[model samples]
Every structure is written in C-alpha cells, then in structure tokens.
Target chain A: MAKHEHKLEIFRGYLKFKSNVQKIWGVLIFLSIVTAIEVALGILKPPILMNYFLGLKLINWIFIILTIVKAYYITWDFMHVRDEKPFLKNTIILPLLILIPFLLFILLWEGSYIFDVMLDGLKEWDFDIY
Target chain B: MQASTLTKTKQKTWGGGGVKPLDAAYGKLMMWFFIVSDALTFSGFLVAYGFSRFKNIDSWPIADEVFHHFPFLHGVDAPMYYVALMTFILIFSSVTMVLAVDAGHNNDKNRVAFYMLLTIIGGAVFVGSQAWEWKNFIKGEYGAVEIQNGEILQFYDIKKDKRIPIDDFAVLQSQERVTHDDNVGIWYQSEAKLPEITLSEVMEGFKTNSAITVRVEELNDKGQKIILSREDAENKLSSATRVVKGANLIRNEYGNPLFADFFFFITGFHGFHVFSGVVINIIIFINVLLGTYERRGHYDMVEKVGLYWHFVDLVWVFVFTFFYLV
Candidate 1:
C-alpha cells in the first residue's frame, strides 16, 4: 500500500509543522510544558488552590485536567488518531469518553456516600471489626 | 485466471469493498482495539483506587507524603520531582519512538534503527526507576505503630516538624526477645520475622522523648493528620500493639493498608506495561536493523509498535497524576 501524506498541524491549525518529525517534536514540547506545570503545581501547592471545588481540592482538579490535556496530545499526535478517519477516531475515543467517566462517577459517588454513613452512623471503624 | 490475480493482490469486494473504512491495515486496527480494551482495564483499577481513597477519605495517606523520595537524596523531601522526571523520561521515549516511525516512512533504515535504539534505552531507564521507587516504598521511611483498634500512629518531632524513624528513639527494653523459629518452637508453629522494635519499646521511647508526639491516621478538616495533645498522645500510646516499619501486602506504616495496596497494584501494573513495551521495542529494533521492513516495501510494523508505545505513555500520564499528583 502507498503511504499517505500526514496532516501536520495541531491545536486547530494554530500550530503547523513543515514535516511529520517537526510535528512530533512540537507535540513533545507541548506535553513537556504541560507536565512541568503539573509538577510545579504539585510541589508548590499554592495556598489558593487549597480551597475545595465540588468536594475535591482545586489543585487536584487542576492536575486531573492537565493530565487529560497530556493524554490528548499523546493519543492525537503520537498515536496518529488525528490522522485517522473521523469515523474510526470517534469509534475508538467516544466509547471511552462515555464509559470511564460514568464508571468513575458511580464508584466515587457510592464511595463518598459510604463515607458519610460511616461518619454519621453509630459505630466507628477504628480498624476493628468487632 | 482473473480470480487468481485478485487473490494475489488480496483484493475483495467493497464493504468487503471500496477502501477500508478505518483506512488502516488489519494489524494496526487490532492493536487499537487491544489498546482500548486495555485502557478500560487500567481505568477499572484506578477507579477502584479512587473508591478506596474516598471511603477512607478521613485517614487516607497523601500522595506526596508517601512517594517523596529521589535516588541518593536521602533525608531530602523531594515530592513529585522524581515521578515528574520519570514522566519526562517516558514522554521523551515516546517522542523517539514516533520519530523512528517517521523515519521508517521515509525508508531511512539507519535513522529508524537509531531512534528505535534510543526508545529502547529510555524505556529501560523508566522501568529501572520504577523498580527503585518500589524498593524505597517497601523499605519505608518513618515507622508507625498499629494500635489495638487498627489505626496506625506515626511519630513526629513537634519542634523539628518532621517525622522521626522508629529506630532513632526506640530504646530497647531490658528484657531479651527471641525469634520463634521452627527449631526453637513447637514444630510447624513458627512465627514470621520479628519486628525491629516491640510495642513496649516504642511506648517506652515515647515516654522518654517529650518532644515527639503521636500523629493519628485520621485527618482534620485542613487535610492534615491530627496530632494529638501531649496528654492525649500519651493515652493513645497505651493502645500500641505492634511496630510497623515498612509497607507490605498486609501492613502499611504510611497510613491505611489500602493506600499501599493500590500504590503497588496500579504502579506495578503500569511498570509491567512499560517493561513489555521496551521488550517489544527491542524486537522491532532488531527488525529495522535487519531491513525486514525494507524488503516488505513499508514500515507499517514500526508504526504499529509506535502506536503501542504511545498508548503506554498515555496510561502513565494518568497514573502519574492519580497515583502521585492527586
């Protein structure tokens, strides 16, 4: 089979590379910067982020979002999902987009509910079964 | 005769027809499917981790506190830095792998082999770093005491504002202790290896060191473990049952056993993936050096392996955030 031309722009055509290698490095730089920000935020843990957002630390939410950003670049650029047919791309990504969050929501929600019951209920865990 | 030609070209009717919908070869498509399924499995593990963390939210160990070590930086509090470095290594390897695939597309055999070699080295270093991290975790830092109620209590110097290892202040009791080996005890009734410090020894040391306070597993609203008042700490010390030094499948000095359990399972699973990816990269590297793809008229195999390598990196990004950052 013949090799096809690779689309070399990222971030909605804002950043364009002359060749496939250049695009790969460009994505690498973006990912590294994102990871640096995550590490910095984690280490510094600026006092402002100590506040809560939707029952989780704002810093944690920031980390989670940045992680997703990194995941996007890895999948789109490195895995060439960006170059795949739209139908193929959607088929691979959409199922996960729907399923993972649903799973997380149900499990985490239940977990916290149990936490509340334990906190409000009569007995303490105190690491003891009896 | 016409049918023979079609068979030789591997052509079939449309829909079984007109250009593959995925526009990818069967092998590459199968890899993608495998990655999707594998991704789901990892998500299940991580979500279970999150579930456990939330259930024990009051006393769960903080990520930074537990994984705060760097190589040769003994006593230095380097939180997230080591893991961040590991992330960079993995990401750099992924970049090299993609470059190899790009070079393969150009049929530049030498460049493809060189990049493949770099990818393999990067992956190996990542695996080694993970092993080191696991070792440090198994050999814990500040040992804690498990109370009769099951909660763990760690020692901290209020003046110094740092954790002190149990060895530092554990004054040995006057009485001698013995390991219950099969030879010394009733046959088949031997015991596990004895802990470095006994409950009485820890309590005695606590009594002698006035500055050291007991930090309970439960946390306050500020998200820090509640350090008991001096009198309360003394009272709590009476309940000490055993001295827990390091993490294991059964005990975790850090805080909850679940914390250590999840850390091991998730990172261990991810490390396994990285190790396998390195192995696969080595095999593919040999193929490139031998010009297998060159004779095949394409480097689709290199591209397929690149996809797998990148998927490994993607999983690590999530693991790093959840396991170390969050």
Candidate 2:
C-alpha cells in the first residue's frame, strides 16, 4: 500500500492545525465567509458595481472572482489537493488551463455571430424557417 | 514474482513504466481526470447559456422576478432567498463530507459513519428543495400572453408595483374548453394541455381594469422591463395569439423560451449530479457500517468520494453565481 500523509496547515500557515479535524473546521469557516460575502453582494447589488466594466457588469466580475476563490479553497483544502504531489497537480490542472479558454472563446464568438445573423441578416433575407 | 525479474522487465519497458508516475494511487488519479472532464462538460453548458443570454440581452427575463417564491411565504417577494439557502445546504454537505474523509484518515469509524450520514441527509434535502423550486417555476405565479411575434406580455399594477395574476382579473366564461387528445386528434398529433384562461377573456378583463398595464419582456436603458402605456398596451394586446400559463420547452410565461430551456437543462443536469452523489454516499455509508475500510487499514475510498462531493459543491458555486446572482 502507498504511504499516506495529510496536510495539517492551511491559509499559508496563518492557521496551523495539529490534526485533520481542526483543518477541516478551518477550511469550512473560510468557505462560509466567502459564501456569505457573495450572497450579500448579490442582494445589495450596489449602483457603483452595477456600472459596466469590460463590456460586463462590475458586479458580475466580482461574482466570478469570488467564485474562483471558493473553487480554489474547495479543491485545495476539501479535496486535499494541497497534500498531493506536484506532478499530480500539474497533470490535472494544465490541460484545463489550456482547453477552457479555447472553448470559451470559440463558443462565445460563434454565439454572437449567430445573434448578429438573427438580428440583421434574417430581417434582410426573411427566410420562412421558424 | 521475484524482485530481480520484475526489475529486469521494468527496465526494458520504456524507462521503467511499472512505477506509478505521480506517486498517486490509480483510483485517485482516475477520479481527478474524471472531474476535469466533467468540469469541461458543465462549462460547455454554461457558456452556451451565456451565448443565448447575450443574444437576447434586451429581452432576457429578470431572474429575480422569475424565481421569487419562498416555501411558506406565498405572495411575498423573496428573491434569491431560497436559492441562497439551497446553496448553503449543499456547501454544508461538502463540509460534512470532508470531515468524514478526515475522520477516515484517522481510522475513526464512528465519526466517519456519522458525518457520512449527515452528508447524505444534506444532499437529499438539496435535491428535494430543487424539486420544489422546479415546481414553482413550472407552475408560474402570473400567466402571460404570447404575442404573434413570440414575445411575452405580463401584467402589472401601476400603483402597487406588483404583478397581477390572470386568475385575479380574468372573468371566467362559460365557453366549453376542449383539450386535444390522441383519441380526438389525428394519429400521433396530440396537443399540449390548454392554458387556464382564453385570450379574449384576458383582453376583455384588461379593457375593464383601468389600473392595469402591460409589461413587455424588453428592458429599457434603465435596465428595467419596459411597461407599455394604456394605449400602447392595448395595441400590443391586439397581436396576442396564445395564452401561456407556465414554462415548458416550447413556450414560457417568462420572456425568451430559451431562458427557461437553459434553466431546466443546466439546473436539471446539476440536480442529477447531486442525486447520484447521494446514492454513491449511501453505498459508501453502508460499507462504512460494514467496517470495510477498517479492514483495509485505510479509507481511500471515502476520500475519493469526498473529492466528488466537493466538486459538486464547487460547480454549484459557479451555477449559483451565474443563474441567480449575476
């Protein structure tokens, strides 16, 4: 059987745990705080954040950033990726880093082009296809 | 199986292929790979949703208005509250699952069993709540009229700033309603269930109600739905064809049928994931009770399933952000 090791610390050693039980609580609290902030922001939706930034709402960017933060904590702490070997981490994450952006770019561009076609081209040509 | 013979074979097979490259057990590595692929699949669905949303930006339904129902609070406007509660439930389950894995690492069978049971209960609750939400969404609160151009026209009380349900204003008529069934219709050409109110009844009611106005799905520059004047409202209502009650694949009381389509598909797919996760947790819970992991001297199986549970929770974080928050 392979040897087992548990990562006993999180938050860059700001909060260290002597046991896995304590570590679990620490990560849980961190995740809860993040989620609370997200819900509050969603409810408030302040006017400043409602302004557009980079073609999207500023509030949307905040949500996306906070979501990524939550994902990181869940993966690293809850899923025990912190204890995994470097090779294992790279093997799993590298492919996603490459493929996700490519897929997003292609799909979003194609969708907008379709939108344009539906808006302008359809009006001009008037195909009977519903 | 001598060591010397094994070493000789390993040396010959492409620079010692017999060893595990990343020092991870076969199962854990495979679970990680599966998670990555599954993440991509979910991303595809969400991006497609984003595309359709972008396409119909002006006419997209406001999610807050669509999902305003709470469990006990009928007629109260509680936007995103239930969904937030559901998110918390799922996240709490993920916590319990990680605690179970932690207990497993320590070889504490009782704690593992307890936490695993809690995780299962949490998952079940989330699934049930999702079903309730789907029910409310499908049986829409206020019905809308489908214009000839496939646009939806909802009613609003100008003074109250509230939507008026069709039942409240629509006068019931004695006209005999016929539902197209397979027995009466042509073979294999059955029609969907008819809406509760007819278009003429709705138009007549609107004519009598002086305070009611029509709200279209299109958003104005202020980011609010465009409410037509009494004269324009009458003009728009003249083009009404079908009376839509709730949401389905073809039409919805909410604007843009595609919004409801993506809502059903994405959330339904996620609900299916949560359902399967609960079943898998139950199986693992049974094994824990049987002392299977104790016999093995390690609880790696529990840890692998924990990874999946955490992934489900992670995906919900994104889904909640996109579907409700943003």
**Best lDDT goes to which candidate?**
1
Per-residue lDDT of candidate 1, residues B1-326 (tens digit): 11111233665422322335467776677798999999999999999999988899999887788888988888888998999999999999999999998888898999999999999999999999999999989988889998887889999888898788888888897657787778765576788888878878888888899999989988898888898888998888787789998899888899888888988999999899999999988998998888777866677789889999999999999999888888
Docking class of 2: medium
Off by over 4 Å in 1: A123-130, B1-19, B183-186
Model 2 clash pairs?
none
What DockQ was computed for model 1? Answer: 0.68
> Any runs in candidate 2 off by more than 4 Å, and if so which?
A1-3, A116-130, B1-19, B182-190
Error of 1 at B149 (Å): 1.5
TM-score of 2: 0.91
Writing each residue's lDDT as its tens digit, candidate 2 over A53-128 gives 9878898899889888888888888888888889888877788788878887887788778777777886746655
* Cα lDDT for residue A30, candidate 2: 84
Query: Which residue pairs collide, candidate 1?
Result: B13-B16, B13-B17, B14-B17, B14-B18
